[model samples]
Target: MTVVGKFLPLLGWVLAGVLMAEPASCESWVDLNVGSELQRPNEQTVVDQTALVRLNTRYSAPVGITLNAHYGLAHRVRLVDEPGTGIAAAQSTGADLRLWDLPTELWRSDGDTWVIEQNLDTLHGVFYWGAQEFTVGRQPISLGVSRQFSPLDVVVPQRIGAQERSYRPGVDAVRWRNPLGLTGELDVGWVFGQDNLLFARATQQWGTVSAEFTALTLNQAQWIVGLSTQTFAGDWGLWQESAWLHDDVLSGARITLGADRSVWSDVYVVAEYHYNDVGDAENMTSDFFQKGLVTLGKQHYVALNASATPSPLVNLNLGLLHNIQDADTLLLGNVGRSLGNNTQVDATIEVPLAKQDSGTEFAQIPLRLAVLWSTVF
Candidate 1:
């Protein structure tokens, strides 16, 4: 269907949700963002501009029902023949898991410069009883504990290089949560549509230490067993998460060890090491040519991120990713200033310290700069 045709049904749903609840009991939000990115991997430079609009509506009552929905529209214009892997799809495991083949791309300009896409990112109903909560419909399901790399976030793994990491795209799923007293909880989720998946996790805390155990199955295919823990030692925060993945093609473990600390007020740093044994890096840049690749090329890697708020309204951050096996590295830096009024602006740059034509992992990533402006009301 046309983009407009597909979006019509979503608009109706959003309106119906708002109208279903008393005006006083309804809550709604809208977010608008405009982002521009420049890539200069080689002599041929490219510029891409994207504008996104999101609408979120929720209705809750003490006795009746609760409904929530989210919708988004994005318009993008970029130079033709440029190389890029869609960042949105990269951040979403559900990009490959939806049962319906409904593509979000609405339309494209004749000259290949413009693409319009819209998605019903969230449409879920919530039920609450005492300390138990259940959510059904398409919703966001994020798992795991690691920051840069997540071994247990099988449902929607965050991309390591995503510029905007505030939101996770929703997948068709059902989730249940129950508190096991004040220090622990049991969480479960099931996803369907493209492929199916089921997982359950139990989390408990003791003193300043916390731990989790998870078991997950990929419908008819793979199984994952995971364990993770985090604790504080005096002034430092430490964490480790590891998972064993088993499938027809591969069986191995992915592990991550991380630490974070604040040296002083307004300054923080994080370091992590990731060891991926189950992924194949044979074709290192497969996604560079084709999109939607689910593989880890280099096995051993390290990531570091540090940020400092110099003033009440200004911030600076730096990050690094190094491939231990290949000696490839990527350096990242960004600056941001709060504009007040629930709005912000940020500029970021990434420099890959390897040759773009090399077989090494980070080397093939191009130099990129991006600026983003966003507001919520």
Candidate 2:
């Protein structure tokens, strides 16, 4: 048997206990999406400095498929496939099977629940790890209390291979969670044999206000610090976040503030401003602070987004942005339609109404359209 094959059952058993102990109320759902973007030289979505800049936007779309199937054999044993392998040039399938809720009594006394959640993006199976209960394996790591700058987003699928979108494989590592009255986590990972990627986070609640802090060490480049606070006032929710990054050469900060109002059922409007200190002329750019650039370190912006779900199978989003530094403007519109229980389709278009003086001419006329189909069983 292959090495991976030999370890399957043991890993399955470990994952089962973790899932039953902390299972989130969920249902098995499979998602397949195909999308494309249009723009000019270096006018695509913002990413890290370590990533290559695409000179031209073309007919690129996510062609991959994923699945997560769970069978509750008993109250304590569930069999499942994390993301059925369908990702290699040689192997058309990327499937991994796991067992959930084995020997589920580990945390019955704690009044906490466990759920086994897996994604196609991270191929590794994660069980609660160590004394901290850290979910380990290939997983999504969201750092900080704010949404603007996420320094721990290494496993994003679109960043690794062209066939996948918003999916990424987890690095080999151990993660821990501390739930002793407060909630927090610490994670350590090795990417490309470099073991410097470390993450720590904590969140607390006090009456109507909450706060969170997140910090990280770059795999080989920098250190990041972030903090955020949020409060509810009447029908509006207000929040703010600030982050700083430092390394051997570069140094910068980002501040973001926003408010959201839910005036109706299942509908909301949000206004946010993100200001990035993207200048470090004396110091080289650090790898950890790459996604902050909406225009490659050229502009600051305030954006408004409105979202509504009219039904269980339909969703819509409308966005407008104004670049505070360069006076550029942007408009975006998107909609999604669910085709079945496991399949759906969506489309997005972004238009730049004004251009910055950075001299990237193609950024003036960025447009895109795409269609996708996916399934699981």
Best prediction by TM-score: 1
Each candidate's TM vs. the true structure? 0.86, 0.60
- Give the alpha carbon lDDT tens digit for every residue of 265-365 in model 1: 88899999999884465533332112222345668989999999999999899999998987889999999999998999999999988887777777667
RMSD of each: 5.2, 15.0
lDDT computed for candidate 2: 0.47
The candidate scoring highest on lDDT is 1
Error of 1 at 285 (Å): 13
lDDT of 2 by residue, 148-182 (tens): 32322332312111122333333444456565464
Worst 10 residues of 1 by lDDT: 284-293
Q: Candidate 1: list runs displaced more than 4 Å.
A: 1-24, 41-43, 79-95, 101-103, 282-295
Going through the candidates in the order shown, the clash numbers are: 5, 24
